[model samples]
Target: MGLPKPLRLKHWQDFQATYQQGKRYRGMYLLLRVLPDPRLNQSRFGIAVSQKVSKKAVVRNRIKRQLRAILLSQRPNLAGGFNVIVVVLPSAVLCKYEHFLRELEQLFKQAGIMNHGH
Candidate 1:
C-alpha cells in the first residue's frame, strides 16, 4: 500500500516549510528532510527525484517506486505529525533495493523519526 492522501505532502507551502525548518538525514541514496507539524497530527511525505539523477523518466519513476515501497513497508514505525521528504541522489540508481531500504531505515532510526522497540 502507498501513503494515503492525508499522509502525503503535496502543496508547495508544505514542501517549502519542511525544507526550511526540517531536520536533515543524509544517506547513501537519499537525503531525508523532516519537519514536525502539529496541525496535521499525522505524518506526510514527499519524494523528490531530479532529472539530474536520471535523464530517463522511466528510471526516475522506478527510483521513486522503490523509495515509496520502502516507506510504505515501514509506515508503522514512523512517528505521526511530521512532514518528510526523500530526495534521491544519482547514486541511488546503482544500489539494490535491499541496500536502499537498509540505509533509509538506518537514517530514520538515527533521526529518531521511527518508533523504537519495533
Candidate 2:
C-alpha cells in the first residue's frame, strides 16, 4: 500500500511547482522541498528516488515504501496545506527505517512543518 490519495502528490506539474517554489531542507539521506498550498485543507507529499539513487527497481521501490510508511506515521503531527517533496539520496539505499524516520522528523522540524500541539 502507498500514501492515501489525498496525501499523495501525483501530478508532474505539482512536483515541478514544489521543486521550483518550495523551500528546501537537506538531511543526511533525504532532501525535502516544502511549499504552502493554502487552498487545500491537507498536506500532500511526493517522493523521488531516481536512478542516481539506485539503478535497481527493487531497491528504489523499497526506499519509496519505507518513506511512505514514515510519512503516514508522521502525518498527524504535520501542519496542513503544504506540498512536500522528498528526494532520496544514493546513501539512502543502505539506510534502515529508524534512520529515515529520525532524519525525516528532524527535517520536518527544521522546515517548521511539525505541529507540536499534536
Candidate 3:
C-alpha cells in the first residue's frame, strides 16, 4: 500500500512554507525538503512539478508516481515525525527508478533520517 491521502500536504501554504523555511537537499532528480511536522505522530509529504519541468501531463504524472513509490518503499526507514516535500526537477524525466531511489536514500542519509551504515 501507499501513503494515505490524508498524509499528503494538500494546501498551497504547506508547500510554500516548507520551501521557504525547511532544510533541503538537491539531488539528481529532485530537491527534498525536510521539515518538522506540526502534527504529532504524523508525517506529511508534498510533491511539486512545475510547468518548466514537463510540458505534458503524462510525464509529470509518471515522475510523481515514481517518486511516490520510492517514498512508500522507504517509509519504514523514514523518520516518523516529519513533513517531507519533494520538488521534481526537469532532469527527473530522464532518470531511472533505481537512480531515483538511490538519490532519495542519499538524501535521507544526509538529513539524518537514515543511517549511513544501514
User: Which structure among the candidates has the greatest lDDT?
Assistant: 2
Could you tell me which 10 consecutive residues in candidate 3 have the lowest summed lDDT?
A: 109-118
Q: What is the lDDT for 65 in model 1?
A: 85
lDDT of 2 by residue, 1-118 (tens): 8999999999999999999999999999999999999998899999999999989999999999999999999989999999999999888989999999999999999998999973
Quote each prediction's TM-score.
Answer: 0.93, 0.97, 0.88
Regarding lDDT, does 1 or 2 come out ahead?
2
Q: For candidate 2, which ten residues in a row score worst on lDDT?
A: 109-118
lDDT of all predictions, in order shown?
A: 0.87, 0.94, 0.81
C-alpha root-mean-square deviation, each candidate: 1.2, 0.9, 1.9
After TM-score superposition, the amount by which residue 4's alpha carbon in candidate 1 deviates from its true location, in angstroms, is 1.3
Q: What TM-score does model 3 achieve against the real structure?
A: 0.88
lDDT of 3: 0.81
The weakest ten consecutive residues by lDDT in model 1 span 1-10
| Residue pairs in collision within model 2 | none
Model 3 per-residue lDDT tens digits across residues 1-118: 4468866888888888788888989987888898887573656788888888989999888888888888877876776667788888888877888988999899888877773456
Q: Rank the candidates by TM-score, best first.
A: 2, 1, 3
In model 3, what lDDT does residue 45 have?
A: 81
